[model samples]
Target: MKKNQVVLFPVLLALFVFTSCNAQKNIPVFSKVVYEGNDDIYNENPLKADEFYNPILQGTYPDPAIARKGNDYYLVASSFAMVPGVPIFHSNDLVNWVQIGHVLDRKTQLKVHDTGISASIYAPDIRYNPYNDTFYMIVTQFAGGFGNMVVKTKDPREGWSDPIKLDFQGIDPAIFFDDDGKAYVVHNDAPNKGEELYQGHRVIKIWEYDLEKDQVVPGTDKIIVNGGVDLSKKPIWIEAPHIYKKDGLYYLMCAEGGTGGWHSEVIFVSDNPMGPYEPAPSNPILTQRHFPGNRENKVDWVGHADLVVGPDDKYYGVFLGIRPNDKDRVNTGRETFILPVDWSGKFPVFENGLVPMEPTLKLPEGVEYKAGEGEFFPNGNFTYSEDFNSEKLDYRWIGLRGPREDFIEITKKGLKINPFEVNIKEVKPTSTLFHRQQHKDFSFTTTLEYKPKSEKELAGITAVQSEKFNYVFGVTRKDKKHFIVLERTEKGSSKILASKEIDFKEKIQLKVEAEGDDYKFSYALNGGDFENLGGTVSGDILSTNVA
Candidate 1:
């Protein structure tokens, strides 16, 4: 147990020291990646017995929202504006995960402290009502005072409960629990269009919950699916809903053409969870947006699905997809795959033929394949080099609205941020610290050495998706000369795009090189040869459908 934690500030000379270590096997947890152009389909290592892997939860970890409380299998995602947003992974074997907490860890449970990077938290579900043992979730607080909320936890690793807003207006929220135990929430309602109609006309409400008094049961609020799943070709943003109940029949699912490149995944049915349902005769059941090689393999935005059932009973599906690296270059953002369903029809489809997202399969029968658990699961051609030497910051390092701690510090000569007199187009917390473009041709390199007391204090390395959409690449000190810049922003507006005047400095090494979402950037001044620093930089405008 190598633990050391420290955090001095003394008027901001800051000296963090958090050094904890354990999963090391020469740094191998997960690494086998291939499928950018499909090298022959690699990805494997779901603990290894007959393999398993296809994101399984890597990088951005978008939308996903699984549950299941007996043999354990939590899962949660979409922590926009990342703070202690939603992120509660634990898996007995839905491809071996591990994160344990974060359902909105305090900050007054984030009732909007100035959110932006695409607004605070949206799309989350995760339920598990064991008739009230508790563990709900239901979210969608996109922006200050937006609606739908709910949090609970008899003990989701050890925290939660405090957000119970939900008067309900819309945005991917879900709850559904029935067998007479009754509990419903299902959302995504606002999209009326009294005008010309045809921009993903949406609607799909339903509410009836009074788990004692926790709200939503006012007028039963029903509207079970309206403009989506073939409204005569006017389907977009049917949104992530989910409702499942199998056999006695209730299904519902969602995610229509809106997360880009026409995302898909329809479905409907129902003996009665609310009203007359019918759609799924294979209605957009699952889609790689019509994957016919998807422009010769760039993958394309796959639906948002959610279903779960395992403990060997099988049937899985978690969604959100991306891995474009080029044309509309998606710098590995929306992630978390894993399909394999086919519950013998009537609903759960997608077991074969989906397009770009099947890198390996098999492993699900009763789990027990413990060969090594891939050391600790972070590999997709492992190159995630951090080097802050521990002391804190590696829950896949994110930041913007939720990480300012006076601008982070991890001393030992690495991972130390600082620049915040307001810079990256200032939406606020701009000391920047990303990390979630996990693949699609990687390489991030850092090594900055900062000493900028002037030129507005710019300390390097950025790729942010907020604070006005980023690109940065740093080093400052103007007039006295010491440049190497290159900026981008675009929404809150900023420009530079390339600079260069360095003859010396405190240190410099910068590098980005993504290669599909096109990044390039490069520096290497005290060590040499990275030096490109010009062109490239698209990343399809960051993403989540152009943040």
Candidate 2:
């Protein structure tokens, strides 16, 4: 399959028969079909583990915390207002990963405009302090509905220390430093406004901080854990805590109900690092127990974990799951997934704890770049159509907020973008033309040539997840010809299933393929034979935080 994959093999066999009829209706039945030189779809090198096997980091929007520093492992997601807000990823073996740089590129440390999509910086947590090698970080701007912030660094790559505010009102803070030195700081509380509190169902605290006086000691704020297990079952909105101690006891791990679906959940403990912490009679640990009549175990929003240990010491957790590929709108975002935690008499378990991250023979030893190997570019298979002349922007492009210098220019014959008018329903934080959701069953083609002056000068190709679920697929303008819609949009609702009648002046190529959540669109005109424009999407577009 060379020569442009044999001219993209009849458009990838009509998108592999509409992804084998949407994978026989929403995956699992031993879902298979991974391709390209398989070896379980390209041995774990930099974790694309054949495109997504229980998320151990896939693409787009990775979220809050995961750190390990001895054999090297670091992770720091949540790029909320996007521009270079947090990112950082490096792995020695926690199942391959790469990207290493980004922790709020100093715009005075984070501005986050309209803050949409669950309000910007929420839950960060990263730590590394070999007696002072330093590298603490603690986010939570939650649109500043209240305080919770901190940043420090010895050098995870220059510049950090700024946003200091921390009187702590709520929204995932976590910081535990004990060994003999003592310095706790768990979080989540800020409900009481007649209680529908941001759906995190409220209550769960633990203070005592003062990294040499950064604050939080006045009355020491400790409520260890509340919202009594099942008060009619509502108050489980505890946020992303994390506290680890083990052996002498002190566990804590958090995240419960309300990250969306399957009722999130992760709860943990043994306790006494400070408080009567208990809750672990095999608590929710994970869910989605095979959905058929279970409906993917009804709303599987599998917690926001983050433990670590491996290199053989065992105990690995990593969390975040969202599975509803297409049917009924779950829009694929929130991915990161790695699990293995047993413990035995103290209890932990989790192997089929809700099924999803399968497909692992063990890979992760390294050295295997496949897909055109090395320094990229046309050498392997990179073709945003003749490269589109890149000037910078290409870690496989990603922007849906934060990215300006006049949003895109690139020349030598392509990429222009420059029309910004905001209000695709009150826009949110800015930046568009996204990318990252790499291969959940690949194929995303692009080719545009607009010459419009009016009719809202639109252009196409989108899949997006935050303008509240997307679809788009080009060509508009009604009465004067040029039609060829697809639309979709959600939450704010806008449907256009399919459309026709075109002749938009000239150049047209537009193509889409997707696979998992089902996608297929085509066009050719002036190169010939492509047509098909009927639409079908399934669900999950990639941004319920981490995908």
Candidate 3:
């Protein structure tokens, strides 16, 4: 019926790591975070004028939900248990996006202080209502006993109000404001009691929303799209319901066939928003399932899209897509992609969405594409180096489950961390900070000025996808000798692949490099040559697939 949705480590020489897990009594600190993207695909097809990259916002930003207000375009994506949930982005041109802030930034707004990595916000929707002159963000908090919630703000940049918990029980909830000033909320819901015809059977439901009360009116909900385009086909996981009205007809769009290779975007039409809807002739307007498994530049699992009128006054869409490596593994997680929609016909069709997607597209007028850090959201090949000198950390550097400020602090020296007593198998937030893996071939190295006096104390670098799926590479003490180790955790099982005795020293450079599925963790002594601790290992376990 519904959906949803982690990060680490010590600093001063500064730069590093996801959900933290340890049975130690020590806390660690880190200084800076340096990430570089060197995908072979980006090298093969460099960015050229009149063309832009597919994912304007990269590195695990998935389940995209978008809305446009005049010249300002606002987009949101699923954050799961990551603190400061609901990462909100802004772009007037759509091609150049910059994250403004999180809608759930305050402690009162995000209650998943100790929830699992897979719980919290899921497939969130952001809409601007001209009638109320307010922006509404509705979502399902799968943790903290908050089933579904909505938050509003006059201006998102200034911050959002506390969430108005909606009395509903579904995920992927969205609100649509009609031209007549009436508002309606739609989301994916489970079949009533035992009516589930097959596995993954679900229904899209809509309810009359009370603007003043900021909740759904009692007993006015209706199931808009049941089991997807054709119930006879028994479509599975029909979710991410969004409603739009154009030319006196209500258009409902949703994602079907789960969030895997079978994923596709479907559309329906009705005379009313709460209706008996009809599937479009071109039911699946967007998908990559038809493409071969061995195709180059593979972008699989494409769906869960949202549409918006671009600055050019043309229809454009932002959707979730996966760019699996040659090994057919997802390490970067689901990313957000954009495409122009051809709505001049009877129904809308995603241009080139059904076909094998190209990595690049000719730029539209008034659209600007730029890579690297700064105002334009980095795409293509770029380098991001962050020094924790400012009071405010980059929005990209976030915490897992708990607030980052609780464990990490920004100071003139570097980012400091006060680790919590997190026992192995304990459900608690880690003393860590995190940045997403942006490319298949990239290097992330941070100088760690640390030494573990005891066996429990450690400080190094790591690649963490969640509490149960991750790799830890750091230094620890054993038998009065300093040693470094590489550990891997997959689906709750963990094992140490390699450990070596080493002379302790400050300013140890810890690095993790990757090429497609192969990952190698290494260390250097006081700017010495990097020593490979673990033989190149497979990174298949580092995936956040909601399959």
Candidate 4:
């Protein structure tokens, strides 16, 4: 059933269809895609003048990391098993951002072609070092049999170098280039051999990094923070370590607790880059665990942050957070968010972060909030469309586990997809091109021209969270006629909700809309009025918890 579905677009367009269909050719063409974001929160509050919404890079973009090079700022997020791993963005002011590209775009760079959706690439850190004038992106890639890899380039726009594998046993690795021209790498490692006191008991280890060799020095490895801030309390899952320098002191910041409700960002300071660091008096600097869950537009799971100096000469932090629907299910995935930091005291604190978060920050004095300019991604309520007219596609549309080039082709007519035999239920990468669920209340409409030659062929739209959790709605053959079927897959078990027997000659319009927990799927034949297919289904299966 993976053959006919080709091309995915964030914006609603005349779905994937061409005037002519070659029976011998296996290509399924999608002309255009257009999507408009219309969440209730945005419509109520609205973007007034200089204000923008929280979760700047919306939809499942988690584990945010930031790096600054003079006036230009760069931000990145963990892509997990998505091909073109590690989505990157650029901005002059933190308010307006445009996606630059991805760090791992080539097939050789991403080896998750056969791995599970949640098994590859965790907690990526992007840093621009002034010493060698290079940008470094380091992370732990679990699939493809690689661990703790780092890649560098003089600039991010041109692309990145092949991985320079770090010889370490850990996850969430970050590199710090000191003012004295020295480099050090810090990461989360398991309690040594027999030292495992408890589950989730982990250690943050540091090693002197060789800039020229692009590897860690074997002899200088040392543990900086073992078992988190207060060993007596016994913190669990302390990871995502970042080192920052202010004046003469060095700060080691990491995400503490598990990535669930108790998740938080903690800080430690020391005189040396690698030393006996002391936890800050004000630990758990940024978190939402203390607030009530029923608050308006509540944001939870606040942790995994990276800091940078803003263009306004103030400190700012970018991290991951989630927006749970009325049912308290995380369907759209973890999103990247930004907040101003107060570093005037001994250590930095996320401003207004302790309170219920309303992340409409005032843009830096002179900068104005502009939406939909060039590649500058628009937040708040706005519309975006793609026609697949270009030779290269936007970075926002990504493939799962495998590179997009392997399955897609750009032609004058439209975008075509060569489906793999693999379905979305399996761990292997499918032919689906995903535009992560951006807004909870939104409409996705596509007019596609596809003919199911057999019951084995199905082509349409799907709302997916992972291989095991998703809603599959597409057109296939049943008996002698073509029928549209809707199936919901949860925890690897699928149930067919409804199937419609329809007669159509050329094209059909399909749509899936959601309002919080309720999701509806419908289709229109030959440009007729859209008719409902599967009444409404719960969107919880399409969302996930951070843990």
Q: Which stretches of candidate 3 lie over 4 Å from their true place?
A: 1-29, 423-425, 544-547
Per residue, candidate 2 scores C-alpha lDDT tens digits across 341-395 of: 7655564656665654454324434423332323321111123323456576444
Error of 4 at 73 (Å): 1.1
* Candidate 3 lDDT tens digits, 434-518: 7878788888877676666677665676677666767888888888999888888777778999999988456677888888878
RMSD of 2: 21.5
Question: Candidate 4: which stretches are off by over 4 Å?
Answer: 1-26, 545-547
- Tens-place lDDT per residue, model 1, 345-366, is 6667777636555556677665
Judged by whole-model lDDT over C-alpha atoms, candidate 1 comes out at: 0.65
Could you tell me how far off, in angstroms, the CA of residue 428 lies in candidate 1 after the best superposition?
Answer: 24
**RMSD of candidates 1 onward, in order:** 20.7, 21.5, 3.5, 4.7
Q: Could you give the candidate ranking by lDDT, starting with the highest? A: 4, 3, 1, 2
Q: Report how far residue 135 has shifted in candidate 3, in Å.
A: 0.1
Candidate 2 deviant stretches above 4 angstroms = 1-77, 84-137, 140-183, 186-208, 215-251, 255-279, 290-298, 305-321, 326-331, 335-402, 408-432, 435-503, 506-516, 522-547
Backbone clashes for every candidate come to 9, 17, 14, 11
